[model samples]
Target: MRFNIRITVSLKEGMLDPEARAIQGALKNLGFETTALSTSRLFHISLEALDREQAETLGLQMCERLLANPIIHRYSVEVLQ
Candidate 1:
């Protein structure tokens, strides 16, 4: 079977997000009020798997092994048809 997987990766709390901060600053300078901001990455992958459980397992392994830094980042995986 084929699966559409989405992995969302983000920095853990207490980690500084300079790019997000910069964007927020720019927005505020442009007259948009903002309190806090953070940045994340989304990866959309299409791959073959035997079943939904296998697809979800593969997605998590992908995140743990390569997509996310376990120490500094937290990630979530979704399997979509």
Candidate 2:
């Protein structure tokens, strides 16, 4: 059997504001400078023990149900076949 597993990563946009600020402060402390900085969440997913086509469908369903909020932000999936 073949498998095409996709991993989707997402984050709350405004939720990262505070983290971004913290990163900026850390940078300042380290004497590293940047005009812009941002933060995001991460997710690692996999679909195994399935064939290529089924794995694709599973990845899509996972994205629609859990990986993406559908209200804010966008998501991308990467499949390893």
Candidate 3:
């Protein structure tokens, strides 16, 4: 069996602001400060797995363990066979 999987991840709302401020502060400490700001990003993945169930399980794992933070973010997946 062949399975298709897609994963999408992104930063949570307030997460980005604090991260950006932290980066800006660190840059200032390094004497390399800039007015430029930081924003969030998205992670996208597409892969094929040998078994439908396995693929789905692995995809879910990826989301649960690595992709989504769970602290302030949510994720979804699509499995096709």
Specify the highest-lDDT model's number: 1
RMSD (CA, Å), each prediction: 0.9, 3.3, 5.6
- Once fitted onto the true fold, the runs of candidate 2 whose alpha carbons sit more than 4 angstroms away are 2-6, 11-16
So what's the TM-score on candidate 2?
Answer: 0.60
What is the C-alpha lDDT profile of model 1 across 30-66, one tens digit per residue? Answer: 9998888888999999999999899999999999899
Candidate 3 lDDT by residue in tens digits, 1-81: 556676656566556567778889998999996986755444444566777777878887987987778887766666744
Runs in model 3 deviating more than 4 A are 10-50
Candidates' TM-scores? 0.93, 0.60, 0.46
Question: Rank by TM-score, descending?
Answer: 1, 2, 3
- The pairs that clash in candidate 1 are none
Ranked by TM-score, the better of candidates 2 and 3 is 2
Kindly report which residue pairs in candidate 2 clash with one another.
Answer: none
> What local lDDT score does residue 12 receive in model 3, on the 0 to 100 scale?
64
Q: Candidate 3 — which pairs collide?
A: none
Q: Pick the candidate with the highest TM-score.
A: 1
**How much lDDT does candidate 2 score?**
0.66
Shift of residue 45 alpha carbon in model 2, Å:
2.6
